[model samples]
Target chain A: MNPISSYLSSSIGRKWIVALTGLGLFGFVVGHMIGNLQVFIGPEPLNRYGHFLQGLGELLWVVRLGLLAMLVAHVVFTIKLRLENRAARGTPYAVTTRRAATLPARMMALSGLMVLCFIVFHLLHFTAQKIDPSFLALHDDKGRHDVYRMMILGFQSKAASGFYVVAVGLLAMHLNHGIGSLFQTLGLNSAKVRPLWEKGGVAFSWLIFLGYASIPVAVLTGVLK
Target chain B: MNLHLKVWRQKDAKSAGKLADIEARNIPEDASFLEMLDIVNDDLTGKGEEPIAFDHDCREGICGTCSLSINGVPHGPSETTTCQLYMRKFKDGETIHVEPFRAKTFPVVRDLIVDRSAFDRIQQAGGFITARTGSAQDANCLPVPKVAADAAMEAAACIGCGACVAACPNASAMLFVGAKVSHLALLPQGQAERTSRALKMVRTMDEEGFGNCSNYLECEAVCPADIPASVIARLNREYTVAAVKDGVA
Candidate 1:
């Protein structure tokens, strides 16, 4: 038991927590992107899809609560690890040189912070409908919440759409370094596949950026409406 | 060649230190970095001033005792140990900034020398294996696979140098620990204690206050032995399996 506690507190242990939570969040992001892309399918299908999710009553809340728990754990463990990391370097070097580390690798904490803020604003904007209470009352011809219309209206404003694009861009950057790092942390990497995983991570992250940004771009271009 | 040297000058571990500008004149182009320091110390002794305190042994690349960070690199411009770095690598009159490795765990004992006993402690924790106390086993008695032997040899190449820690942005010792863990775990002799070794070593490593590996790979860049970052991945695997087993049993 003592060894287990110490093991969990170790650097590798914190990495497991951070890496697993990051993977779970990545799953949610991909799933959310696919679901939202349904907006391009037309209003009725999108609204019905939204209604079906709301219909799952307890299961939807369960998923929401699970996401929340994972988010908190991710944030808390990351902060703890970050503080330890900062403290480990007692003093700064007189001359700093970076030879092997990439910009994305060095900027994980910074990018993670930006993405977390975006998540907060995102929930306020869409899930709670706090940004525009009027969207809450919009019902389709079938009396279902017109989510497709809500999305179009949401992105019609240049500022909101622009902000969404930038936030997701930051998320993509985070994943640019994170997904490859996740493989290493989970002991899934070896010499032969390391380069492949790293390149794949970069490519996948950009794909997500395009997938997410396409909607806002479509809305602003008058294609999704 | 002449050069402007901004070297750290700490009296001792408890005192704050700053860079002292010392001019190195007529230094030989072929002189190793440590020899240059020797010439400077000799001149300082002639002037009745305190000589700079730095660590070195064997005056060759194999020993890991030299611990100066030259121009913000662990071992100067070369991909080798500081002792092997020569004066020719720098231009005439280059202002070389020399500082000690600045990890909190490897605190500055004096100018250009930090206490690396932290590494020794880590080594003692589990960087070893249990075997029968007897004469040397026959060479072919234990037939290790060529790949395993090569990997083990690679891990064993680490000289317990703290450069990995110094170069890491997080001051992590994962590269060093990874090397040690991988070195032993790859062999048949290390099988008996593999489980406890991973757990105990990691526990000790954490208690020593080294930071997490963020996969920056700076450690690999600065490692004199050229230990790859894959060792860290191997360490993660070893520790995960051990911890899972430990939790249930």
Candidate 2:
């Protein structure tokens, strides 16, 4: 086999790809949460922010496509690894106990799958405006797409926002393990750095959870009119 | 102290098996786990019943030959080999589960013995240096730094135990491969084959049906040799460098 392809397909190399793409995805989600938190600053700033992204035009599409590619690689390789993991364990132990593996570490692929489902729903609800068609028609007094009020109106239904929070929760759980694992996979985790990254992973996961969920919570609680 | 035992009873590789409940009566607290098993086997032999077959050698924990999953934890709830485990860890009447290591690479050879030749095959891939087999070479000939020497010694402490494999959720052999590769890659004597050693061993590890490391650290927790998870990181680094060189060349 060609060395490059062989390396890319090797079990260790595959993890590097997963980690790199996960890093990319992690960046996007953190940025997404920060941008969405503009809801706290009130409507005009939030809508203007949305319009700014839209104003990026073709460059926005480039970013979107790039993220899509990363997501595809992340999901495809993760599922492939998960299946292979199952096959490698010929038989389940009659009894097993967790010694050092954290809850997030064990729930990695499963949580990722759940987060994927939420991503699809989120895109439909906000990005494509499929879940709530009225979101497409909503406009501010300035006639820009009213992303701020759209969010407020979109989050009017408790169920949608609840699922959003739940999805973010699952995403945070996924991040809890993934953030630390990427360091190890990329050979960046030194013995001293390992514990730091593990704790950092937890801190970052909670930040993600609070950052994203705050918007939905504020909307549902009528803090955002 | 008497105890209940759930021993995996398999006649052979081709046969199915289940945990057979056997009463380990009159066991002494000071008896090593294997001794307790010997006592149980003696009882079975005296009664003309088939005794539970387990793998053990050196009774002292130096040999990685004793493979048992006592109560789901590899080598029991201790950071030592099965031979080092004693009855004192258990309470009277507590049921202990003894079974072979489970992995696609390590197949069950008998009752409590899995075919660990998979580890041997991985070792044979690139686990050694090509140093001249003779009396100790002049220590002054090749100078090894203390940091490298210590790391190599730590990695070399691996007894080729499959506890890492047994404990890994994905049944990964990365820890074992990592230790072997790290040990050789750290020394000047091992420099000649370092690049190829990493490439071949990891390739063989994957081809042998070992799963990818998810960095769960379970292997490090259960490792009798105390092989740090950092060796796995080293393996990843070494392979990346070697693979890149191979690709570029």
Please report how far candidate 1 places residue B188 from its true position, in Å: 0.7
**Distance from true location, Cα of A142 in model 2, Å:** 2.4
Question: In model 1, what is the error at residue A139, expressed in angstroms?
Answer: 1.8
For candidate 2, write residues B47-110 as lDDT tens digits: 9998888888898878788889989999998679989988898999998888889898888988
Residue-by-residue lDDT tens digits, candidate 1, A34-112: 8898888888778888999999999999999999998898999989998999999888899868788999898888888
- How far in Å is the alpha carbon of B93 misplaced in model 2? 1.1
**When superposed on Cα atoms, how far off is each prediction in RMSD?**
1.3, 1.3
The TM-score each candidate achieves on chain A is 0.97, 0.97
lDDT of 2: 0.91
lDDT of each: 0.91, 0.91
The stretch of ten residues in a row with the least summed lDDT in candidate 1 chain B is B58-67
Model 1 chain A — which ten-residue stretch has the worst lDDT? A1-10
